[model samples]
Target: MPNITFHTKHIFSALLLFLVFGIQAFSKDIKQCDLLIQNGIDAMWEKDHVKSLELLTEARTLAEKNHWYKQLFLATNNIGANYYNLLDYGEALNYYLESYTIAVKHLEPKYEMIVLNNIAILYSKKKDFEKANEYFKKAYDIAVENKDEVKIGLYAMNLGNVANETNNLKKARDYFNESLPLLKSNPQFEILAKMAIAENDLLQKNYNQAQVTAETLLKTTKDLNYHDIGISLLMILSKSNFEQNNLDLASDYAQKIFARKPNLETKVAVFKLLSDINQKKMHFDLALQFKDSIIKAERELNEINNGRAFENNRVKFEIENYKKEIALNEAQLSNERKIFYSVLAIIIIVVFFVILTLRNLSVKHKQKKLIAERNEQIISLELEKKKSDNLLLEKMISEKETASLLEHEKLKNEIEQKNRKLSAKALYLSGRNELIEETLQSLSKLPEISNNNLLTNHIQTLKSHLKTDAEWDSFITHFEEVNQTFLNNLKTKHPKLNANDIRFITYIYMNLSTKEISSMLNITAEACRKRKERIANRMELSSEIPLYDYLSTL
Candidate 1:
């Protein structure tokens, strides 16, 4: 029995190990597949279409096997790009449609927008302008919704080019202008936008404006080595100059277009411009020569057009077959979906009843539990109420104490301010008394004033009034009122300080000069200074710490 149990445990452990290894291997493969898709996209950007197709095909197979819908969509779309670049429109359309279907199935709007733009470009290549415009608009709306500036600029440029082909000059100009700001970071799109603007000006018979725009575009394209745009700009310049009857300038630009060895279309345009210019100048021989060149260029252009038409027809045929296959698949899927919904509906009904039964049982159980919990909560709440009441009472007491302290501080400040004012008035009164005493003494010393008994009597009355201790008592009372705390604190801290010493410190605390203290004290400044020195020595203060500073603290 013990051996059997050990073997069973070992078997279980082996199965678990197998599952873990299997999952790890699967995850590693998924990462490798994703890396291949990324590398494929990078290759496509490098214009290695063959290498891109090989890598993307491998990624697509892996994604399909793993049921990774997102990577599958990306791989399929890049595969389409490879074929599109190779000019295999039929295969490109097939893969693009597959990617579009996957994107829609997965509800991936970003991939959907990308596939829509590719489909529009393919249709435009096929010269199915109406269908191209429809798809472009769809992609444009998605780009706007996503706030994708790059995609918006790309779609706008494509729409403008299409509009220009269809001779909708106003719409073309509007789209070109709209794309310009968004495409400023992309030099290729910027040059294309400028070229479109020049073309639009020429078409509108704004020859001077067209010439200026085209010449500027020509300079930019030449500097950038963008020969395609340069050729287009040269054609525009030739046409503009010829229209304005600048035959010599028109001939020079037309020859420049030919000298660049432009494509058949641009060459044809240049030849036609040269022919017109020569005919306008009545040079029949050169005019005939340019016309013959135009015929040859047109013949070459026709052959190219024929090949494109054949390719378009082939793509159209493939598209029709794909549509038929899609229709059949849709029909099959519709049947399957109907069966699925039927089973789903019956399961939902059973689930609803089961849920309802469980909910009723749950509610009954919960109600009993809730009743006990409510009682417990009521007990807890009562305890909390008591605690809250105590806290509230403490807060109320604290607030009342705070208010009382604030009121006491306010009243103390008011009393201090009144005492200070009274002290100032006492100082003024002391000065007045000194002046009156001085005047009386001066009169007494005068020889003419000695005979004046009335003056002498007045002086005697003033001296009697000034000699009274009432003013001193009043001044001391006021000073004590303001400095009561300082006096108390000083007396408690320094028991040896006498009333006279305290009065001397009070004058110093008031920041009064020695002369002012002498006038207030009816003593000489020297006597006031000696009093301060005596206090400082009594306090044992060092000479480095001034006596006035020490007295001011008290």
Candidate 2:
């Protein structure tokens, strides 16, 4: 009886060992499957779709074998994303539907919402707005229910983009506005939202507001080096300036967009803008040149699209084959599972002690390895944090310098504008003095006034007033205030120049015409020209250097 009890105890221990090892192996496979799926997601973020597909496919195999519903859903969804990026829309839709089915079967609302949103994006790309909007609304409702602010903003922006594409400007603007607050954390998305708003403003013929919005966004994009969004903002600015008849400014923005090496669609739009601007400016030759460029760009774009279509077809065929292979593997795994279990049960009875010893050692080894890796990661993070802090400091310094330079430029422009106004006032005063002098001369020559002593005396007093230096001195002082250091600099450069010569240079520096200068000096225009020639000679300037240009250097 004691011998019988010992044999029964041994049999019970064998069964328990088999159960424990089987469950451990299954758990290990599930963990590996999850790790692969995470790696696949990282690959997707890096835009390596081919590698991502491979990783996700391996993960899917493991998930299907172990019947891990959550991992299966993720692996399947990522597979769809790979095909979607590859432009195999048909295959992409098939996998997406499979993922959706899994999500529904498992009652996973989060996965369902994400899959729906992706489907909406795919439809929007295909220009099926009706279906896109339907899916977007469904996804948006789910996001709202889950209180996912990020997804909410993303859907709103997508809807806005679709509305803008359809030329529903009002609806697009409203949607973009709704997205702004939600997407503020993501600057790129915020920029895109504002760009949509600016585009709407342009479509509605609100050129000024559109220009302001586009320009503000443009500065932000340039600072961030966001070339893609910069292209869109530049296009909006070009259109806004074009509609407002600012042809030169429009051409400048369009040319900047071209210089950034835009893609086919943006290039076509830029070429069209250039053509229209040139045509408006009566530059028929340039217009024709841009029109030819447009044709070339459009032809290239068509060829590119065709190539993509062919590639998509090939990818779709490959995906179909891959699906068949996965199905076959599933069938084979199902057939092999019972046989494997029977074998595993017998092996466990023989190897239970050995397996337990190895597993314990392995667990300890893994713990030490994990501790080492954690230490390395901590050090790496510290170094990275220091580098980030350094980069942030450099960026702050650069921004501050840029702000300082801009402030200096603003002050310089304000001074120049004030000088221009002062010069205009001085010119008006000179013209008035000239007119009074001419009136006095004409009155003195009139026959009716020749014999009147009182009139003659009044004319004489006026002549004395014109001869006084007070008014001239006052004008010179005001001119000096506007053009600070100008007269002094000129005198320092040419000490031989007299006060009259200095005054002539000041008038030339103000960019006054020869006739205006002659009137100011109460001399003939020919005399003023001769005076300029004399000053140029005195300064020993070559004929290539005009007197006005030389005076400007002062």
Candidate 3:
């Protein structure tokens, strides 16, 4: 070889510098895109749809140029959200589908789930509940596949909301029930699920129950500083009370919403509710005041709606042209590929025929030898087939045994999982009851509550409703149902165990730590351990064997 002395260090330094600079530039671009997206979202919230679209479009362009699928997805999806809020379903659906395409092609499945939800929401706004349910179920399935509890709860809540809209109250309740426990740690979604359940109750004409649920949720949302959720709860309460002919309570809720200075739609609804309430009371003058307010609010709402439609059309045209450009590029690329593949196929065909022709020329001379070899091969194949059949039968028998074992294990795991869920629910309820009790105690000492008989009575009623044992009874009922066989086996083996002992044993069998069991049982950790030891002593088990381990054998 020729003598070649390369400046390897210099080349390496140059490459390293290029890499570092490339990363910096890429990071800078993404930051800029993020800033644009945030500003676009802010603008959308401000109802400046035109400005929002301008910012989002710029971000989308940068994201697309750099192949940043996440940013591109956010920008596109937000634009769709803007259109959605403007009541432009057609434009919204187009942008949503475009984002869905990006998510499906370039991103992880979780991104696709996000787009699926958006598409479902758009269909929901269009009152296409069937299509909406289809997409919502797909998103929920993806959440299940990913083992994402938060999203599972969220999508389940969405599904339930849609079911409520479609008048399928039973199905709605089922979804909500499945969602609530999974969402217990997620206050935002848990509130939404509760709201949906209350809405379902309202739709089913269970007005008193709906009011109670909404009233409880209002307090929860208020404590969490969830202003919008509180407003929604207020609306539910207002509607439920109104349906029950509790005009005074309904008017009070409507006034609360009005005092919050909610959106024009809410304002219109409140104004109408107040007007009806006053009219029902024969206060014509007060009714006329609200009636006039409604007219003014409706006019403003109408003007805004008309303006949004015009602004949306202008933006829609621009977006449509941009899509057409992308489509044209894709069409050109596809056609080029088709031509390349066509030529390659033709070349392959020509080569194949040449090979076939040569093979035919040698066929006669080798035919007799080939036939003699084939006879020997046929005898070998028959022997192999007999061996294969025997092996196949053995494999089938083995697979059947394996399948039965697997099914038994699956059922056991399912019961264990159900018990775990029940345990979680118990813990949640325990914590919630403690918090409620503390709140009542604090309120009882407050001067305002003590001085006011009505407030004190309300507090007393709330205290009466706080039946800690009732919740535990419900939990035990469910736990017993899920772990029926396990419980029966344990009882049969330990007939001397009492109900409380069995409860303790049940907690131990769930593999809960000492602290968790203590909290659930309202006892200290030391006491919980003593109780465990006592139970073991009663069961006549050795000290070396742990309670959980002993229970597991059962």
Best by lDDT: 3
User: What is the TM-score of each predicted model, taking all chains together?
Assistant: 0.50, 0.57, 0.50
lDDT of 3 by residue, 1-554 (tens): 01112434665888999999999998898999999999999999999887788789878977987899999999999999998987877768988999999998999999999989989988997889999999999999999999999999999999999999989999999999999999999777788888889999999999989988988877657453363676778888888888888889888888888666688988877877887777667565587577668667766766676566556666655644554454455446655755565565556456444545555545434444544555565566566556655755665576566557545644654564566566656544444344445556667677777579998787777566454667667777998799787889988988999989987887777777787677666667799889988999988999998778878887
Q: How far out, in Å, is residue 184 in model 1?
A: 3.1
As a TM-score, model 1 comes out at: 0.50
Best by TM-score: 2
Full-model lDDT for every candidate: 0.74, 0.76, 0.78
State the local distance difference test value for candidate 2.
0.76
Candidate 3 has its poorest 10 consecutive residues by lDDT at 1-10
Is 2 or 3 the stronger prediction by TM-score?
2
Per-candidate total of colliding backbone pairs: 0, 0, 0
**Candidate 3 versus the native: TM-score?**
0.50
Q: By lDDT, rank the candidates, best first.
A: 3, 2, 1
- Look at candidate 1 and tell me the lDDT of residue 133: 90
Better of 1 and 3 by TM-score: 3
